[model samples]
Target: MNKAEIIVALDVPNAEAMEAKLQEMPDFIEWYKVGLEIFCAEGPAVLEPLKRRNKKIFLDLKLHDIPRTVGNAVKTAAAHGVNLMTVHAIGGRAMLEEAAKAAAKCENPPKLVAVTTLTSLSQEDFVDLGISRTVSEQAVELGRLCMASGIDGMVTSAHEAKALREAFPDALLVVPGIRMPEGDVGDQKRVASPSFAVEQGATHLVIGRPILQAEDPSAAATAMLNDMNK
Candidate 1:
């Protein structure tokens, strides 16, 4: 078994809603992704509850900015004691390098991963933005840049996980937009099942709707874990 971890995304509107969702989840779920909605609503204080639970936090801010600003944000996240965090790979080499250096200075640095392309985007969307490369190409190209710039890993679709793993065998490949075979795709355009993501070499699987919105969130999470660990 690959032992790929399941990271439940807390996609709720506020800290209260997020706490309710966490209460619904099983204790076996060791990781949680604290994204923009809840983080922005509650600020750094939003992480306190999860810290009390001793759960690992994946802060999915997808930070994008100039070198100095992003570096400062990285330092702040490190201070918050996140286990993992994301920056936009499109932010380019200088920003990525600065983010890496900031992490290196932390006593307990969070593993910094770069976002290659969002799972909600289609290839046509890239074309609309005047980019000629396919989603996979762009992901791999950015993955290379991330490694060269000292980023620890990347957030990519499972569609590109295999290529990324092959190119950078040691890089942490975090795959989001995970949906069960029978589950609704919702807003994500490039989605995969838990088993598919694990088999493709994803180190962490980020699932939101399927598990969080299920009638029995704990059972749903256990089932997804079974699928990934199979």
Candidate 2:
């Protein structure tokens, strides 16, 4: 069986803490996720060091905007040479297609992924947004939009992974709402263990907290990868 690819989320606020956390990461960690927090705070310059080490970057800015505008933003991000980037499927097919087209122009385009539904939300949260479908239903709809847009992959919670994998068996299914057994889940409402996600056909696992907050970040990451490869 193919072990799920492991990518740690660099959710820290600034470059200093990011470097510290990275130092604690095991050498086996070749893929890293740079989310909005650090990207907004430090800009693309923050990614230079990781690129120097040849680490694959998942620039999770979750771009959601008008089609032309999001396409421009995606072009800029692609210029940064990131390995993966996210655009929200909620932005609609026009926006997603624009982003994909922009990436295709790059000599080394980042894999354009669609952000389906955020894992932090619950069913009650969807009602607040006037969304009639359940989170799973919404994810399925957005995932199909991603497929129609010619996007390369998707970002969804593991709870919805099986459904997505069934729909797009060849697409990169990256799940982020992961909490190891007995770990604090914090704001994420739809979460699962790394093993369950992998078993459900998640291609990559974007894990944070449990690994980054541990006293031994490298060891924590190794353990998680161990679980992924088991």
Candidate 3:
């Protein structure tokens, strides 16, 4: 329930799948993230159960749209009592600002986080996307923009966590792309162990497959928490 175990990414298919994992929820992992897949399949209905359990929620919709649209979207998300939410920094400063402002208006505003370059993207991927800068460079630039726009945090790879912490010491760094030492990489290109991520100054680590796909998810989650404590 401490800051170190602040968030856990639930990248499963739907509420049913997520509920299966919820049975394995450890006391240490208090926060849960509802990403695109789960959101698209279950909508706000899925959130009710988590809310009843009094678990903090992070709605990872990764909203990317024009300023006005994104602002309205954030307002709706905030009303749902989510503790955190994400927007794509690629949506630009105007969109980021609008999202932040919308959340701020909520009686219990969710922390607005901007997603920089995705963990699945490599330097070559950036080149293929016609971006001249390296992924790290793009991440830093996007992070800076998000901070200026009053965002509460950023979702970045652990590879950039150190540099990002240096630039924004007080800002929360919610890192995905986390892998245990023996874990498979899956679709993520940039990854780090949970202990390494915490050592690198990440405020939160978003782990999915390693815990969710394990033979015993609660035990797996406990092991991850133990690793972070080390």
Candidate 4:
């Protein structure tokens, strides 16, 4: 159960749904992510069962706010014993720095990851929002700012992983928007196979629907692990 094998995105609607998935999860997968949906639905209580199972938890709340607020939020997340968490680089340097500082003080700090442009967003989407740069460009710039603020890692698409690895060799690149060869891309505009993501230097892969929607989730997760190792 190496950290890189798989990170199941617990994107279910509530704790009950997550528990149902957990019952079917394979032992090979050692990590699980609690995203906004579940976190908002079940709150911190959702994490208790996963912890009881000895699974490393990644709280993906994607916190974004003013400096003081975000900082306090990071501290609170750390107290919950989550292994990883995310903030928005778009939240600006002050907030990022504040979060970083808060994480640093935690006795066992959760890895602070920053969200760049989401995989669901395309260059056209950015254009529609009056952001003139391409999606890749914006992601890279945001990655830089996150690094400068001293955060542990970032959440980006596999499409940008190689370039980002080159630019920030020491920073962890936790990627989402992963699709298996036979999997559907769904709403994600930027995606890569598990093997491709690993070869490109991604430290972690966040997978949701492909595993969750599979007829056999544990087997699907195992297959994804095999693909990543290949």
Per-residue lDDT tens digits for candidate 2, residues 1-230, read 35678899999999999999888888888899999899999999999989988999999999999999988988888788899998888999888889999889888888988888888888999999999998889988889989989998799898888999898888889899888888899888888888999988898999999999998888888888777767
After the best TM-score superposition of candidate 3, give how far the Cα of residue 28 lies from its true spot, in angstroms: 2.2
Q: Give one digit per residue, the lDDT tens place, for model 4 in 75-155.
A: 888888899999998999999999999999999988899999888898888878999887778878999999999898788
* Candidate 3 lDDT, 10-30, residue by residue in tens: 888888778888888787678
Q: How close is each model in CA RMSD to the real structure?
A: 1.0, 1.1, 1.5, 1.6
lDDT of each: 0.94, 0.89, 0.87, 0.89
lDDT for model 1, please.
0.94
Candidate 1 Cα misplacement greater than 4 A, ranges? none
TM-score of 2: 0.97
> TM-scores of the models, in the given order?
0.98, 0.97, 0.96, 0.96
Best by TM-score: 1
RMSD of 4: 1.6
The deviation in Å at residue 53 for candidate 2 is: 0.8
Where does candidate 3 stray beyond 4 Å?
1-3
Which regions of candidate 2 deviate over 4 angstroms? none
lDDT of 1 by residue, 1-230 (tens): 24789999999999989989999999899999999998999999999999999999999999999999999999999999998999999999999999999999998988999999999899999989899999999999999999999999999999999999999999999999898898899989999999999889899999998998999999999999889877
| Stretch of 10 with least lDDT, candidate 1 | 1-10
How many steric clashes between backbone atoms does each model show?
0, 0, 0, 0
